[model samples]
Target: MSQVIQDKVIDENLKWSKINHDLIRTMETPGKMWWTAVLVCVAMVACAVAAEIYQYKYGLGSVGLNNPHMWDMYIATFVFWIGMSHAGTLLSAILHIIHAQWRKPIYRFAEAMTTFSLMTAGFFPMIHLGRVWNLYWVLPYVSDRGIWPNFRSPLVWDAFAISTYLSASALFLVIGMIPDMAVLRDHTKGWRKKVYGLMALGWRGDDRQWRNFRRTYMLMACFLIPLAISVHSIVSSDFAMSIMPGWHITSFPPYFVAGALYSGCAAIMTLFVVLRYFYRWEDYMTKNIMEKTCKLTFAIAMVWTYLNLIEFSSVWYGHNVYDKELLIDKATGPYAAVFWTMIICGMVAPFGLVFQSWRRHMPTMFVMSIVLQISMFTERWMIVAPTLSMSHAPHQWDILWGSVIEWAIVFGSFGWFSLLFLLFCKFLPAISTYEVKELCFHLKHEIEEEKREAEQKAKNTSAAGSQQPVSGSPGLEGA
Candidate 1:
């Protein structure tokens, strides 16, 4: 009899009941390490707030913005966080549409990351605005004096894109959580039950409810895929629409989208390892799934690397003196260190995943994921800084090293994201309970089918053997 082989996305022996219990337990327990992390995140957020206050009072100069280097770390950090927000769309929307079962265990946290990163990214533009009070001026609304914001400015595009993407992503997140909220509502007590009940919208898990849920979820996933793509493309247009030498490239949109997906995937890997180890979810977040994630990340890394090389090649050969000069400056000038770091981490480092052992090794994958993100962070910095430093007019050239306030604000943004995510972990299920149960159900069915096939094959072989003639007996004479 031939063996039927299948790679499990989760442990084959896990039961639906246990899947529910363990996932619920994740929200119920709070250990010292979690509390300590929350406290540290709070402190970091406080520093960021203090820095923003100082900047608000003292004007943009507090963060070292000047004539040439008008945009600095704030813009870079904005792009970084915005890129990070793509992870949820890639994991949740794209994978869901394709019915990728492995994503079920990890997509919930990735969705939350999308929302929180968008919230963090939204802060940077306001912080960049020296007149924070006039934030609404960027809106398309007209003032009483008939003054309106610049219609063609990339800032307006960002305002529209960010708001739309944020609203859609937040809605998608909440909609996806409803069934889990219903589970929590039924299982919990006190204020949590009440909160979950309200959040659940009185879900009964009846046939009609599930049918509608499936339909709505699929629709949202479909809508979000293109929306996610467009959002980052608009962000890229913030540069591409500009006449600046390096920023005005035609390839910037696709380049930005690829880079965003690459960074987002890396961020997901980092969190995947963290949640697996911290929650002891070896059965649910199995190595098979991690390996698949690594493979996808590796593929995206290659796409991003190709795009990077294309940009360099185009600039080098296109006979654009300003663009070529700026490219050379980025490679050989003060920012060369950061430029090469991006190249190594974003392009070369992902090749480690080619080794099956490294991809499955959680600790190594975790470190590599963080390194990839650091590379992405430097990439955004390189994008902004080198362009501004190598401006068309040599007299306007200046490199912004950024000030302490800028650094503090960027640091705080991380803390803020962490704090929000921690609260999400406390109150909400990081793993999709119903989805994990679905995986368990499918795995059990597959195992049973394989067993039945093997048994049937064995019985058939025995019967055939029983009917066959012996080598030196009556059956051989009959044959």
Candidate 2:
């Protein structure tokens, strides 16, 4: 048995080594379209920087904020981005707890999206302040006035929740990358090797190191599950706690969480499709993985749809004059088109995944994911704009449209995110090479074990045949 185990180990190592060689060669080859993508991302950043400078020179008045609709596109975009971050934590932490093998390839990119989206989302509240210099006043720290931030304020809760989530996500990203960083360190040379070597923290594939690493990762996964849920809940509370019409529903927390996960799943799907094709990870990120992702997106999209219906029903049935009026205005007023589009894109189009073909086809799934993301953005806009537009005062019921500068900055944020992701792929192993190798090792062992069992059965059969049936003459004489 000991010898059998040793042989199995050797076989597994050889199989994994071959796979690693193939993976290295594929990743080393740059695609012809890579530079085109880089150029587009650069142009987007430049456009965004110019727009931001213009906003700074002209002031917040240049954008779309008035008496009632103070929180316009910027706030909506912020919420959308923050919600997008939830997918990473869900995939990494929650799925890890459940031991989903498919998550191994997807989790790294998802976590990166979470970290970058959180960073992007952090910018909005500051930009919304307009007088960004006084941003520190939002903190609970001691001020010259000797007053703390209102403990009961939802905005303060948002500040605390977002900060905590960002910190946790950063830590999660670093921890997840450590093993892969060690792989890079082993494979690289010169400056790249030194950088990865330092980041790897002397990981040496020792038994003790593996035990501790797994323990740390498991603990982090446990912590992140609740953190991800609470972060989105807190974000929802920002509006739910408000007494404004269309905002005070009890369903807001779960609704927001669902929306977050819905958009997040879509974003993950989009990124996975891109990465699978761009990195040529057709073997690792299989059709089955894409189908599973789409299934999740469809499930969450249905939940979001149900929540929307419930929200509308509760408001309509309660017969609160303010809530009814706001609902009516949102459904029939100037923003009616956006509201319907949100429903169709967010809730309706995602139903396409019910078809087996749609789930299997990467391009179709990719388009569906993009539509879901766009619709989710529209949902965020609906949440913020409709309430702020149709306030208690009749005279303030003006439609708020984002300025050109606002659009530029928002588009730039996407550019920034894409840019970071692209650079990450170029430098770091986007798919965890070591993790894949480990899986390959396990698979190899399983295959070899089956082969050994089959060989043993064949040998036993041959021995029995020779002993009982080789010479029929002696057996017949005895009979």
Candidate 3:
């Protein structure tokens, strides 16, 4: 049995050592395109930082926020980023528990997207604050003035939730990457080795090391599922807790969660196709995975649409005059055009994903992913904007089109997230080397088991033929 297992372990394609080298090679010598992308991202981030500085010096009046529209694009984008962060942890945790093999390659980058987007999401509140220097006040602390933030405030609640989500995501990402980092530490020399070695944290890949790593990883994965759900549910509460008609729906949490997962899944498609092309990792990040992601996105899209209709129906059916009017405002109000566009993107566009051609075709899926992200972004904006625009009291109502600085920050966030992800790709194994090795190990084990069964069946057949006259004669006496 041991020899059979040993022979089965002889995988031509997945020698653990060879996989380390192959994956590490992706980071070895990036091309001109990689450098170019990094430079562009840095430039965008610089522009954003510069814009923020200008806004700081010039004051909140530098942007278009006012009256009923006090919360503008920053809040919307923040929500969108929060939503974006969901799919990563969801894919990593949920699929992992279900033992989905496709998740192995996808989850590494998906989890990275979660961490980077959360970092990006974390910044929006400060950017929205306009007076970002006072950002520390959001922390649960008392100054010499003995003033404390109202724990009852949804904003404060959001602060706690975002901080906690970001921390958990960072821990999850770092822990998962340790084994991969250790692989890099072993393969490199000098500074690179030193950095990877430190991150690897003395991971020697021994029996004890393996046991502890698996147990810890599993615990974190289990913990992250509820954490991920709660993070977005809390985000939804930022709106749902409010008295505003659209924002005050009981269904907002699940609605927001579905939207988040919807957007996150689309993001996975976007990154999946781009990285597959750029890294030429077709075998690992296959078309099958792309189609699977599309199916998920399509399913979630339907879910979001259903929630949209349900929310609308509840508002329309309810005798609450204010809520009914708000529903009317959404369809034909000042920013009704934005709402309709969102409908087309969010409610309508996902229908295309149902086709195999759209799901499997890289080009189509890429375009669809982009559309879905934009739709989700607009959906967040619509959720916040319309509620504020037509607040129950007419006097408090104000329409806000985001200022130039606000737009710049939005672009800057994209740069910030993309830059972090690109850096991660350049440094760490973009796909999990250790996980893939384990995958190959299991596949080898299964193949060997099948081979043993085939051998046993052949031997039994021979034995039966040799003993046919005597043994079969007893049973065949009638014949």
Candidate 4:
């Protein structure tokens, strides 16, 4: 009897050759839509560059950086991009360690997302500085005047944390792609072959090479898990270490980490749908995988929501008037609309994932993921702006809605990130071929084993029935 496999991770009928051909074909050619996207991203990046130049020429005043609100949209966008970077570590390293086979098909692009987003995030700190040329002072180096970088400053911490995270994450991404690079080297021709060959590090896929690769990759993944956690925690310290009311919460580290993961997962969902649909990878990027992702995203969302509520309760019950007033002002102040948008989108919209149909529906999941990210962006803004807008010294209070240049740079960041990701997809293998083959092999073995067991059970039942006397013939006499 033919039996169906429930909740299949991938189409069982897929061949290894087909997998290679389909994935590599994406890099071999580009569609009109792909070119259109690239042109648009380039234009957006151009606008952002112009805005940055304009800002640099005129100084911070061009971006509306005023007293008490020095940290505005740029810092908020920085945090949002940093948070976006976390999903890659979660999917690639954390899930890899846990032996989640479903991650194999999607983790490549996710890792790419991590690296590109870090590149995007690293710019904001420098942009926030009125004199961007003086950013080198944040580096831990001896100055000509014998000045050392202030270790206590959170900005210094950001410099160290983000650089370290970017280095480790970039290494992780590149290391993970080496085997695939070898495949490309062997398959392609001319210049592409030469490039891939150099990148593959002369990988021959021998037993020794495989063994070493596994060890190195596993070690890197193990290192990355804690590194990812600490990076975001340090980022949170940028605020938590401050004396400001809302920014000084004890729970800010975990809160920030949760928010980071939440945003990252939402971003992954958005890209997942886009890649699956654009590449026509339904056979590999299956609904079951999407459902699992949705479930994980929903779980993270709930955790984020819990942390948010906990912050509110801590401030409300701690009777810290400054913190309480800031929280109230967020809900009912100049930024009330943005605050509520964050609440509705971050806290409430994730509930849509709890429904099975919605989670499996690509269009619905795509829309929901974008909504969640918008919510997360606003969340970072609320965290930075509201606290700055209201302080213990009422005389120093000011509201900053950000200026056109600030908005342009913010818009350009998405374009920058998208351009990098789009280019990466056009050139590299976005899906891991060997890992997906392994997944298919193991799944096939499992199905065959189950089929054998079912056949044996059926045989035993038939033999027992035949051995017993027939009901109408000799069963009554035998009994």
Candidate 5:
């Protein structure tokens, strides 16, 4: 017991200095490229704001809203951002539940992605609602007119679902950061120390604090998994609950959920590569973790492929002429190019990950991630636009594309999300410090155990060889 305790103490001490030095280094002022990127992102966001202001002064007509195709790029962008948010929670919360120790090194930035993506997603509904001032009316609160938001509406469902998810995800990200913040607090001096100290919630790393922290974190993780699942499912209902033939499918919720996880994993890789290059964290963010993430993404991609096939097959094989016509229009009409790009990127590109060596190739993975990002965005757009463009009543049919304001808002959302993430890197630990130490502890033990086993095998072989064999034994001559 004494030896065990001593070993634990030594192991804990082993990683502290290196972990602190490496992680805190990310918070230091970055290079010229980073600043350049920040300036570009800020400028783009300014342009987006200006575009929105113009749209506000004018009307929804600025986004080319027609009778049949009212939902355009705004709704598509909303789904895209919402899907991006899912990977973070899956990386941190679900992996934590499964005791995936490798998640420790990468989950911090992934969860940060979740929090920021959700913030970006929250912008779309207000954009969709031309009278953005009445945004609060979507809430469940009672008003002076004794009115309430219609609970039956999927839009209301989206309000409750997204708000709940944002709150829980924010809590999850902050709570997980506290212990690492405390580590930062102990190491820093003066102003930075005080800042981390406050953010750490006075974390002390005593037995009681750890106990409470673990329990609370576990409980929150349990809550977030279903919440994450529900948020996107509700987002799907905005289309599925509608009476439109193509939109009224039972498969949408699970399909949306899978797409969310699929795109999310790709987004993580995108951010992972950027940060790894800039921060020089090649050690913790190793090739093996990247390989695992790629493999997971490949699997989700297959799942999404199956779901996509199922949607198309169901539409074709079933007796619904309206759905079949919409699907046909999406494949052969003006949007055919978008549909094929989604197929090639979303379905075919992931197959490249089947080769283990290819998965380890960083540049290959990065480019593939970009492809998936485009494919996923187009997937959401195709889901919304093509079906609406082809109404059951021939007279109601109309082709529609997003306007300049809509395109500006899309670009702006990307800039806004990037700005938040860059600021996060500058201020907080991009990688979790103490969690890396914990990972170090487990890996150190595994290495030590393997060494001991190897030594024991060598000893046993030596002892057996040294034993005098009978003269008649065939093995004696070789020995």
Candidate 6:
């Protein structure tokens, strides 16, 4: 029993030492590329802010919105950002539930993505309301007229769904970080230690604490899985519930969900690739893991393609002339190039996963993931723009080009997300050092046990050889 205790203590000491070394390495590494990413993100955000200022001073007319097309790029970008947020939650929650060991290294980064992307997404609905100052109307509260938000409205549902998912995701992220926070707290000396200490929630390496932590984590995983699904579905319903030709489809909810997963997976893959390269985590984020992630990307890509086909097929076979024309416009009209590009990128590109070489190749996987993301963005654009551009009234048919200000805001939003993630990697531990240590310990014990078994087998074989007659000596005597 004493020996066991001593072994555990030594194991923990070694673990902490390794963690401290990694922390120093992360801090010392001059992340020039990370700085460049930060600058680009900042520039994007600045443009977005400038656009907002122009819109606030001028009016809603600054954007391309009219009678038939009330919702524009803002709404499409909002949905796209929200869908991007779903990837992190899906990767973290699903992997946790399945007890995937590889997830230990990647979940922290993915969870960070979820939180920051959701924060960026939350900004859109408010900005889209034009009178951003009157955003309080969406809140569920008492009014002088004593009326509540309409429960039947899909918009209200979106408000609830996004709020719930965001809160739950935040909680899950913090909870999962407790152990790592404790590690940081212990390793740091002054102010950093104090900050991390509070965040660690007074975590102690005790059995009872671990038991509670495990139970709470399991519950959060259960909650997050369904919450993510419902959030995207509600966002899709915002379009589907509308009477617009392209928007009024029963398949929107599931199709949106699949697209969300596809894009989310792609974003996560991109993050993993970047993190692995920048952090020197070749051991943690191995080719094997990348291969597995690509397989998932391929699978979700197929689902997205199927849904696209289903949506198009229904449009083609239906008797409604309006819907038929809308479909025709999407295929051969002004947006045909974007529509075809989305198909080739989202559908055809991912088919490369069928080849074993492509799955294992890092550069190929990274390029494919980027292409998939761009395609998903185009898919969202097609959903919003083409429909609005080709309204039922021929006189109302107008091309909605994104204004300079609009472009800035959109670019800034992307910057905002990237900046947060890049800063997170720089200051905090990117890979969970403590979790990696635990995995190493587990692997070490497994190897030790195998070695012992092999040694015992060798000893047995030697004893058997001694007990048996020497075949060569016997033959020589007989001769």
lDDT of each: 0.91, 0.82, 0.84, 0.91, 0.88, 0.81
Order of candidate numbers by TM-score, starting with the best: 4, 1, 5, 3, 6, 2
lDDT of model number 2 = 0.82
Q: What TM value does model 4 have?
A: 0.95
Local lDDT at 255 for model 4: 94
> On residues 398-447, what C-alpha lDDT tens digit does candidate 3 reach at each position?
77778888889899899999999999999877899878777777767677
lDDT of 1 by residue, 127-182 (tens): 89889898988876757889887878878888998999999999999999999999
lDDT of 6 by residue, 1-479 (tens): 23333222113234557655765577544567767877888888888898888888887775655565677778888988898887777778887789766666667888888888899999988877889998888888889998888899999999999988888898988888788778778777678789889988899869999899889988999989888988988999998998878989999989999999898999988988877777776667777677777888889889999999999999889867888899898889988998999999999989888898988777878898899999998899999988788867888888776777677778888988988887787766666776667756765676577668779999999997887777665533454
Candidates sorted by lDDT, best first:
4, 1, 5, 3, 2, 6
Q: Estimate each model's TM-score.
A: 0.95, 0.88, 0.91, 0.95, 0.94, 0.89
Determine which window of 10 residues in candidate 6 has minimal summed lDDT.
4-13
* Error of model 4, residue 62, in angstroms: 3.1
Can you give the lDDT of residue 461 in candidate 1? 100
Give Cα distance to truth, residue 46, candidate 2, Å. Answer: 2.1
Q: After superposition, how far is residue 284 of candidate 4 from its true place, in Å?
A: 1.6
Per-residue CA lDDT of model 4 for 328-392, tens digit only, reads: 99999999999999999999999998899998899999999999999999999999998888989
Judged by TM-score relative to the true structure, which candidate is superior, 1 or 3? 1
Total backbone collisions for each predicted model: 0, 0, 0, 0, 0, 3
Model 1 whole-model lDDT (C-alpha atoms): 0.91
Cα-lDDT of candidate 6: 0.81
Q: Count clashing residue pairs in model 4.
A: 0
